[model samples]
Target chain A: MIPVSVTRDDVAHVARLARLAMSEQELDQMHGYFEAILEHFAKLAAVDTEGVEPTSHPLARANVTREDCVTEPMDRTKLLANAPLADGECFLVPQIMEDE
Target chain B: MNDMADDIGLLNRPAHELAALIRSGEISAVAVTEASLARIEALNPTVKAFLTVTPDLALEAAKATDDALARGEELGPLAGVPIAIKDNLCVDGVLCTCASKILDGYRAVYDATVVERVKAVGMPIVGKTNLDEFAMGSSTENSAFFVTHNPWDLSKVPGGSSGGSAAAVAARMAPLALGSDTGGSIRQPASFCGITGLKTTYGRVSRYGLVGYGSSLDQVGALAADCVDAALLTAVIAGQDPRDTTSADVPVPDYVGELTGDVTGLRVGIVRELMGEGIDPEVRESVLTVARALEGMGASTGEASIPHIDYALPVYYLIGPAEASSNLARFDGMRYGHRTKERAADHIEMYSRTRAEGFGPEVKRRIMTGTYALSAGYYDAYYLKAQKVRTLLRLDVEAALGQFDVLLSPTTPLTAFGIGELVNDPIAMYMADICTFAANLAGVPGLSVPCGFTKAGLPIGAQFTGRAFEEGTILRVGDAYQRATSHHTSLPGLLGAGG
Candidate 1:
C-alpha cells in the first residue's frame, strides 16, 4: 500500500476526531508534520509481516481479578480539587444532553 | 571521603555514600539535605532542571532520619539521600505536571507507588523535575515550563523527556532522580547529560502512579552520577506491585552487592546495526572503547545483528503514538487538569478548545497522527502492521541476547546538539534516538554509561542491553567500567561551586 498523501482536510478530519480544536494556521502546520511522518511509514508497508502476531503489550498476562470486597475509594474532595468546574462533590461539565 | 569521590563537596557525592556518612554520624542527614537544596537554589534558575523544590519536605525527612540515628537506631540504606522525582509521577499534594500546560495548576492527590516506597525508606525529597509535555518530544523544549540546559554546555539541550532529571543529576543538584523511559527518553538524555542511567525491563518496576505515555514501553528507572548510585536507586524502586499486574513476580536482585565488577568469562556483542551509518564516528569510537575495555577485563567481544532493528524508528513512531492516543484520551476537559473557560455550546466543543489551548505542538501532532492511523481504513496499514513488526524486532533481540550476555551500542548517534538544531525537523530529531529506541521496543533492560567525550567537551555514551529482568548483568558491566575509567567522575563546571 502506498502511503496516503494526507491533505489539510485529512489533517482537519483527524484533529476533529481527536477532539482538538485547531486554527487554520495550526492545520496547515500539521499537514507538513503528517506528510513527513507518513513518508517514514512507507517502509513498514513494504515489509512482509504475514503470520506475525501483534504485540499490544510487552507482558503476556490478563484477567487480574481480586476478591470482591469493600474498600475505601479516592477522597471525593481531593478528586474534585482539580476539576475546572466542581459542584460540591461532583465535577460539573457542559451539558451533554438536550431537553426533548 | 574516598579517593575517587574526592575534590567535589557533599553535593557531588553519590547518594549511597551520603547514606553511609549519615549512618556513621560523620555528618547529619540535615546537612546533606541542606547541601543538595543549596545546590538547587544556586543553579536551578540557569539549568531549569526542577519545576518545584520541596525544602519543607526535604528538611522534614532529614530531621526524622536524624532523630532515628540519635536514638541509636539503624539508619535506612538511603536515609537522608535527597532525590528528585520526575513530575509525571504523583507525589500527593505536590505538583505533578508532565511539564504540560494541560496539567497546569494541578496537584497530585496521592503518592505514586514509587514515591510512597521512596518516602517509606526515609529519603529526603528534593523536588519535581521537568520533561517534554506528556513525554512527547526528544527535547525538554516541549516542556511548557522551560528547557533544561545540558550542564556541559549551556546552549545544548538535555535530551528528553527525562531531560530535567538528567540535568539535575549532572549538575549535582540531586544525586539521584527517577525517570520513565518510553523510546529513548531516559538513556538518550543520560548520554547527553553524562550520567549513568538505567532503564529497567518493562515489568521490573511499577507504573501504578506514573502518568501514562506509551504504556507497554514505559519503565521507571534512575539517572545517577555513577553505576553504584544507579544500582542503589534501581534496587529500591523495583519489585512486583499487585496494583500493576504487568509487574513481574521476579525477585529483585541485590544490585549493589551483585556488582562484583566482573565481566570476565561473559560474551559482549557489539550490535552492528546500532553503530554504523547514521551514528557519529566519534560516538562509535567511544562505544568501541567500552568494548575494548571490557575485552581487557577478560570478556570476549563479537559482532551481532538484530536484523529487524533498523525498522525500529518507524515502528516506534507508530506504536508509541497509537498507545499514547489511547492512554492520553482521558485529558478531555472533564475529570481533572486544565479545562477551557470559553463559553461552550456542547461537550465536544469544550474538549476540543481545552486540548487545543492546553497541549503543545508536539502533543497535538502525536494525537492527530495516532487518530489518523487508528481511524477507519488505515488501521491495518499502520497501527496493526507496526505491532506485528514489533514482534519481529523482539524475537530478533531475544535471539541475539541468547547468543551473548549483553549487546553494546551508542546511546544516541551523537552527543548533545544545540537547543534548536533538530527541533524543527521532527524526523531529524527522531534520528538522534536511533541507537536507543530498540531497547524500549524489546522491553529489555538497558544502561548508559559515560564512555568518552568529544573534542568539543561534550560527553558520549555506550549502552549495554541486557536480557529481560537482568538489570544486574548490565549494571555489573557499568560498575566495572566506572571503576576502571574516570569519565563518570567528571561534572559540568557550571555551578561555580563543586570542584
Candidate 2:
C-alpha cells in the first residue's frame, strides 16, 4: 500500500501548482483518485534498482545542432489566424498589472 | 453511387491495389474519392469516427493525382488513396483539435511532417478522426466530442485514443489511416477493431507536428486493413526529419519489399508474464494459437521471462503524465486556443480559468497527478523511482530480445469492454494497457495483428514486438501470419450491408 495518503488539501495544492482550478466536488473526487493511483504505483518500490541509469530516450543520441542559417519564416497573417485575440501583429492578453 | 460502389467498391480493396487501379486508369481518382466520401456520409453518424470531413479538399487532391497520372508522371506508392488522419496531427489550414476544448478554434498553420509526406505522395486526406482529449485515455469515451463506436459491436468501445482511425479502417470508410501511440493507443485500438496497426520505434518516425502527450514515448504510426498495406504506409512515412532532432538518421528500408514471408530461422519468445493471471481466457487462447501457427511455419517458440514486465503500467503512468504535464503547458490561453470569457482580475486568473474550463476530468486528474509526482519534495520517491524502474524494464526487454528475434503477447488483457465499464475506475481503465506498454517503455517497435474473435464475436489481437529499429522483422512475421490465416479478411457485420 502507498505509505502517503492524499487529502483534499493536497489535491487542491497540486492543482494550483499545475495551474488548474478545481471546485470542491472535483477536489474531493481527485483526492480519492490520487490515492488509488498512488497505491497502484506502490508496487514499483519492490524492485531493487541500485546504480541503474535512468533512460530518458529509447535510443542513445546526443543533442543535435545545426548551422545557424536563416530560413523563410511563416507569414504573420497565418500565424495570427488561430489567435484568440490579436491586435495588429501582437497577441492580446488580459492586463498584466493593476493601476496603483 | 451504388453503381460506383459496385464497379470499384473502393472501400473493400487494399490501399496498394487502389493505387495501382488508379494508376492504370481502370478507375478515376475522382470516382474513388466520391465513393469514400459517400461511405463516410452514410456511416459516420453511426460510428462517430470522424470529427471533420473535407470532401472539397479530398476532391482537389484527387483531381491533381488524376492530372499527374494522365501526364504520365511517376508518383509515390500511395497516390490517389483516401486516408484518415488522427486529429492530433497538424494539417495546414485544417482545424487540428486534439479533441480538447482548449484547442477549440485552433487551426494549424503548417503541416505535420507525416502529413506533408503523405500529401506529397498524393494521398487524399478524407477527414480528421476523433481521439481521446489529448490522446490521454485507453477509450474514446474521454473524447470531448462523441465516442467512436466499435464497428464489431456498437455498445463496446473501439479502444482509443486512436479509436477513430481503427474504427474507420474496420468499417471500410478508409483504406489507410494514421495514429499516434504514446503508450498502446494505436495497437490496442487496432486489436479491438480487428485491423493491423504498427507502432514504429521511437525516433523512427518524426514527431514534429504530433501534439505531445508523452514526448519520449509518442510515435506516429499506421493502421490499415492488412500487414502489406500497413508496411506500404510505413515505408512512405518512415525516415529522418531535420526539423525533429530525435528522429534517427537511419536508412529507410524497403519495408514493403522485405516481406519474404519466411520466418523459418526466426526464434520467437512468448513473454511469460504477459499471459499469466488477469488476462481473459479467450484472449490468451488466441495469442497462444498465433504462437502455435508461427511454430508450424518452422519458427521456434519458447517462453522468455521479462521479470520487470509487471511494472510497465505504473512506470508508464508516471513517465507519460510527467512529460504531458510539461508539454501541455503551452496552452495557457494567452496567444491561441480557448480563452475564458469571464472577467479576470489578472493574467493568472485567466490562465487558471481557461484551463479549468478547457480540460476534461481525466486530463485534469493526470495534470494533478504529474504535478504532485514532480513536486519538490516528492520527485525522488515517485518520479525518480519510476524512471529507475523504467531502466530495469528496458534492460529486461533488451535481454529477452537478445535471445529471441521477436516477442509475442496479447495486445490487451481482454477484448473490448463496454464503453462505460471501466471509465469510472481509473486503475481498472489503465489495466487495459498492461500487455502493450512495455514496448513503449523500451522504445521498441510493436505490431498488432488480428488473430481471431472471442466467442461473443469481439476481435482478438496478437502483438509482435521487435528490437529497436527492427520493425522489418516484426512486419515480416506479421505478414507471414496474415498469409497463413484468413482472419484479416473478415469484416465487421455492418460492412456487409453496404456501409
Candidate 3:
C-alpha cells in the first residue's frame, strides 16, 4: 500500500509552484516516487531532534565578507550568445504579463 | 622519453610521468596530445565517456606546453596531460550542458574556476564528458545525451553522475578528469571504474562556475588512475577563490608531496553502521580486506559508530533535491538553453513548458520532490526537520572522526550493476549512495580507492573519509594502499581490443 501523504493533484500543484509543467501521466509517475521516498523520510520523524540546531552549510563561517568593490562582469555579447532569444542587449522573453 | 622515443605507450601512463616526459623534451607535447586523441577516438565509441571531443583545444594547449618547455619555463606537475571536464562545469566557449536537454544549446561565456586552474597548470582541456542531467542520479542513465558504460564490463553502468570522467580515465582516454560530488558522484564512479577519485572538503575547491546542484553539498575534485595523479590534479584545483565566498582561505597543502609511502600509526576506523546490513557480503569483505591492508602497513583499525548515518539517504534525498529545485530554477526559457515551441498564453506557461520539455525524468522527479518538500506547509516538517537532523548527522560524524583519523567503508554496497538493473526502482538506486553521502553532509573529504574486484570481476572500492580539511591524510593512506596493492593496475580489455 502506498502511503498517501500527497495525492496526484498535489504533485501537480507542487510542479506548478516549481514553474515546471507536467502532464497528467508525469504527475502520476511523480506521485508514486514521492510516496516511496517520503515514506522513507518519515523515519526521520522518530529521531529525538529536540534542541538540535539546523545545519544549513556543513562548513559555515560566522560570516563571509567579500570586498564591496567592482568586479569584472561577463561579456554581454558572449552571455547573449548562450541565450535562446536575444534582442540587441536584452533577453527576449515570450511576453511580460498576461492580460488580467 | 629519451628512454623510449616516438611516444608509443604514453597514452596510458600516469599524468605526472607524462608531464615529466614532456618537461624533459623526451616526448614532445604535440606527440603526446596526438597519442591521447588517437586513443580517445579509438576507445570513446564504445566507452561513450566523452560528450564532446575538442581535439583542436587539446592540440592548442599541448602546443603551449611545448612552447613553455622550449622557453625553459617551469611547468606545473600536470603540464601537457589531457583532462576531461564533466559537462556541468563551465569551460569558456565550450559546451556546458550538465547533460540535460534543457541546457543543450548553451555554451559557457566564462570558465569554471577548476577549468581555469586546469588551464593554468598546462593540462589540455580534452573535452567535456557526460553526466546525469543536473547531476541528479546514481547511474549515468539519467544523462540526456547517453549512458556511459563501465569500462570494466560494457554491460554495466559507470556509477554517476561523474560516470563519464571515471570511464575516460579508466579507459585511458585521458590520464586525468575532474568530477563533482554532491553525493558520491565522483567516488562511486571512480570505484566502479577501478580508479581513484577524491571529493575535497566542501570549501576546499572553488565552486564559482559548477552548475549548482546541491549548493552546500557539491564540490569539484579529481578522478585519475591512481593517488599520485589524483593528488597532482587536485592540488591544481584546490584553494581559495574570492569569487566563491564559500571557498575557505585555508592554505593548500602539497598533496602529492605528502604521500610519503608510509602510514605507520595512522588511525583507521571501520564504520560499523556502514559495514553492516544493506551492504553486500563480498563488498563488506573487500572493505575489511582494505582495513587489514592498512593494518599490515602499521595503521591501527577499529570499529567506529555514526548511527545517524543510517538516515543519511533520507536526509540527502530531501536536502539535495530541495537545493536542486532551487538551483535549477534559473533554467527558464528566457536566459539560455531550450525554449518550448508550443504556443503559450503567458510567460509562466513558457517557463513551465520549457522545463517540461527540457528536463529528463530523473531530473523532473527530483525537482518535484524538492518543490514539494520546500513548499509552504511542508517546509518545517520536511526541509527544516531534515536540516536539524543533518546537525545530528554532523555531530555524530564529528564524534566518530574525533576518535579516528579516517573512517572506512565500501564505496558502494556492491560493484557495478547492469545498465537496466535499478533504473525503474528509485529507492534501490538511492540506497547505493548511503555509504558515501554522509561525508558530503559533514563537509569532510572522501577518497575512494580500488580495493579488489568482485567474483564477476567488476571493480570494488573502499571509501576512506577523514576529518574536514584532512584530505592529505586520506590521500596519503590511499597512495600507500595503491603502492602496496595491484588492484588499481588492471585496465579494461576494451582499451586493448578497440580498433
Docking class of 3: medium
Clashes of 2: 0
User: Considering summed lDDT, which 10 consecutive residues are worst modelled in model 3 chain A?
Assistant: A1-10
Residue ranges of candidate 1 with Cα displaced over 4 Å: A95-100, B1-8
Best by DockQ: 1
DockQ of each two-chain model: 0.75, 0.71, 0.64
Candidate 3 lDDT by residue in tens digits, B296-349: 999999999998987898899999999999998988888889999998988898
Q: Which pairs, if any, clash in model 1? A: none
DockQ of 3: 0.64
Please write out the lDDT profile of model 3 over residues A1-100, one tens digit for every residue.
Answer: 2123887788878988988888778778888988888788898888888899999998767678867898788789988887788986998876656668
- Could you estimate the TM-score for every candidate? 0.97, 0.98, 0.97
> Which regions of candidate 3 are displaced past 4 Å?
A1-4, A96-100, B1-8, B497-499
Query: Which residue segments of model 2 deviate by more than 4 Å?
Result: A1-3, B2-8
Q: Kindly give the stretch of ten consecutive residues in candidate 3 chain B with the minimal lDDT sum.
A: B1-10
Question: What TM-score does chain A of each model score against the native chain A?
Answer: 0.84, 0.89, 0.82
TM-score of chain B of 2: 0.98
